[model samples]
Target: MQLVVGRIGRAHGIRGDVFVEVRTDEPELRLGPGAVLLTDPAATGPLTVESGKVHSGKLLIRFAGIKDRTAAEALRNTMLIAEVDPDERPEDEDEYYDHQLIGLDVVLTDGTPVGELTEVVHLPYQDLLTVKRPDGSEALVPFVSELVPEIDLENQRCVIDPPPGLIDLAEAELDGGPEQDR
Candidate 1:
């Protein structure tokens, strides 16, 4: 499967090195030198990592034949994708691949049906789960260990401990909105 490794940001310097926003936790394994990455726009290129370094916390990478800042700038916003093995997983148990969470049933602790886990949004700080409800609407639930206490892969379910207003639609519907005058 093709997994996103990093996103090419603006050109870092005049030497063809571009700043990268890493998506994968295993940067050394996925974005290291000699690693080949596929591009998103379909034309920029299937870039090969010539060199990589951490500059002021963000990753900077140089690709073969990209000789100047202008060349690197052309690759801005390109997603670097890497071919990954299906059996491979992150070493940390706390970490989860997006594929594992997709399609799992989302439910409350009391077994109240919330929705179906549809997508995982990987932000810089935290991940968010997009749960599609039976009514066809989606809710953005923060994927935190405390709020999302369990993931039963065997049973294909995710248990959520939602706080007030977390799922606004459900909260509104359940409460019938504000008191209305007859």
Candidate 2:
């Protein structure tokens, strides 16, 4: 399986170093020195990492043969991908890879069907699960333990305990309360 590890950002300096918007949980393993990553455009790489460091809390990476700012800048927005075993699991039992959760059925605590887990949105603060509802609409559920109490991978399902309007915002709007009367 190929997983996205990071996206190339602007050139960091006159050197071939580029800032990276990291996407992987294991940056040390996937984006470290000597790691050969495949590129999204299919033409830009198999780029090998020459060196990497954290600067001002951002990841900066230098690639072999990309010798100048212009060359590094050309890689802007390019996605870096790493090859991984499909069956590989995260070291943390509580953590899950995006691929592992993508296809699971999403249901409420009482077993009410909500949707299918479609995508995992990784944000700076928290991850979100994109759910495709039966009616073809989509809902973003915060991937927090309090709301998402259980991930039954064995059954291919995720159990959520959503507050009102979290999953049914449109319906909630339709059933307006005191504010609607005003």
Candidate 3:
């Protein structure tokens, strides 16, 4: 199984080093030096990690033979994929891959059906679970443990304990209190 490890961002410097958005929870293991990763477009073939460092909380990576800013910039938005074992599991029991939760049904804490897990959005600060509602709408639920306290993978379900306005922003806005203005 191939998993996306990182996505190339803008060029960092003139020396071919480019910033990357780390996708995998195990960046140190997946984005380490000497790791060979396949590309999405395949136009650049495989890429070998020559060096990597964190700058201002962002990860910067340099690929072997990429010697200029133009070369690095050209690879922007490219996804770096790595092969994983079929039976691989995260070292931390609480940690889960996006694939594991993608197809699960999302319900409220009281078991009210909300949506189906469509995708996992990995942001710099936090992760979000994109859900497809029955009404053909979409919702991005932050994957915080407090709001999402349960992940019953055995039953293929996720329980969401949404805060006020988290799920039904329109309803919350419509039922505005005295503190809210028109």
Candidate 4:
């Protein structure tokens, strides 16, 4: 499936222009006319970009057939997706799409299955992988080499070597304890 790159916000002006909240680092690659966007799976209504430009650090796009403010307003909160092939190479081996990591089985260095990756949280410092354990608990492991030693995307597994006290930190956080205690 094609990964989401942006979402259409409310109409910016009466010229069919709409504000786009960019969700990808490759914003420049996604801009321009004739670009196709899929709003949803069931809604096969592909929106063709009539014109687009980066404005105020966000993408300002106008879609074909959307001429008025009302027409643009109707597209608010619509996710923008393009058909992406899996064979497309990534920018780097360490870099991966959040979708690619989701649902992968998380394991310890010894190969003990801990849980499955439920979500990836992008923070200022680092990305955190939230693993949903079999016991219905959640563990937030930082996506660092020290913590997440290996990722076998093909096998759908990840090996982690969490730093000392990291597990206890996750446990304390799950138990509603203070951050300092963790």
Candidate 5:
């Protein structure tokens, strides 16, 4: 499995240095000299990191053979990936990667399937689970333990106990209107 670690933002300066938005919590553990970065599937090979450093909470990196600003600029928006084994040790009980949550079935307490997990947005206050309904509508549910009471990864299902008016709020937002009592 290839996990995305960072995204090349832009060339920083005249040199080959490029600013990268770190996507992983373990940036320090992943970014290092001699580390290999795969931009995409069509690339000839992984780009070897000649040098790297953390700057202003982002990764500043220079790749081998990329020695100019033009060369660095060409890599903007490229995703840096690291090959990870799927059989690796498990994360802590409460922690889960966004990839693991996406595609999971989202249901009400009574097993009524409301939607499917499409994405997870990490915000400062809380993570938001983006659920795509069968009708092509979408709902952003706050991943609070109170609302999302249960998550069964193996079975690919989640039980949600939405607060009063939250489902209406989500529906209103999806419909681009204010919530009105039915």
Candidate 6:
């Protein structure tokens, strides 16, 4: 399996080092030094990580053959992909890869069918599950333990405990409810 590990951000300095917006949970392993990453456009390259470091809480990495600011700047917004084993699981049982959660059935804690998990949105602060409802509408459910108490991967279903109007709010936003008036 190929997983997106990070996106190249602007050049960090005059050197070839560029900031990386990490996407994977195992950045230390996936984006570590000497690791080679494939590019999205497929022409930029299978760049090899020559060096990496954290500065000002941001990850900065330098790739082999990319020795100047111009070279690094050209890689901005390019996605970095890594090959992963299909059977490989996270070290922590509670943590799940985005691919693992994408196809599960979504339902309320009471067993009421809600939707199908279509995507996992990774934000800097939190993650969200994009659920495609039976009615063909979509809702963004926060991927927090309190709201999503159980992920029954064995059964291929996830149980959610949404607060009042949590799912409705997403629908309303799409349909222009009273919240839109204010």
- On residues 78-125, what C-alpha lDDT tens digit does candidate 3 reach at each position? 999998874577898888877788899999988999999999988879
Q: lDDT winner among the candidates?
A: 2
Task: Write down the worst ten-residue block by lDDT for model 6.
Answer: 169-178
In terms of lDDT, model 6 sits at 0.91
Number of the candidate with higher lDDT, 5 or 6: 6
Q: Name the better of 1 and 2 by TM-score.
A: 2
Please give the TM-score that candidate 1 achieves against the real structure.
0.80
lDDT of each: 0.89, 0.94, 0.89, 0.81, 0.80, 0.91
lDDT of 2 by residue, 5-94 (tens): 999999988989999999899999999999999999979999999999999999999999999999999999999999998789899999
Structural similarity to truth (TM-score) of each candidate: 0.80, 0.85, 0.72, 0.79, 0.75, 0.82
Q: What tens digits encode model 5's per-residue C-alpha lDDT throughout 4-88?
A: 8888888988888999888876666556788886776436248888898877876799889988999889888888897766644
Per-candidate clash tally: 0, 0, 0, 0, 0, 0
- State the lDDT of candidate 1 residue by residue for 8-111, as single tens digits: 99998799999998888799999999998989986987899999999998898999989999999999999999998866768987777887789999999999
Candidate 1 C-alpha error for residue 159, in Å: 1.7
Clashing pairs in 1: none
**Deviation from native of the Cα of residue 22 in model 3, angstroms:** 2.7
Say which candidate scores most in TM-score: 2
Model with the higher lDDT, candidate 2 or 5: 2
Which ten residues in a row are the worst by lDDT in model 1?
A: 173-182
lDDT score, candidate 5, position 48 = 82
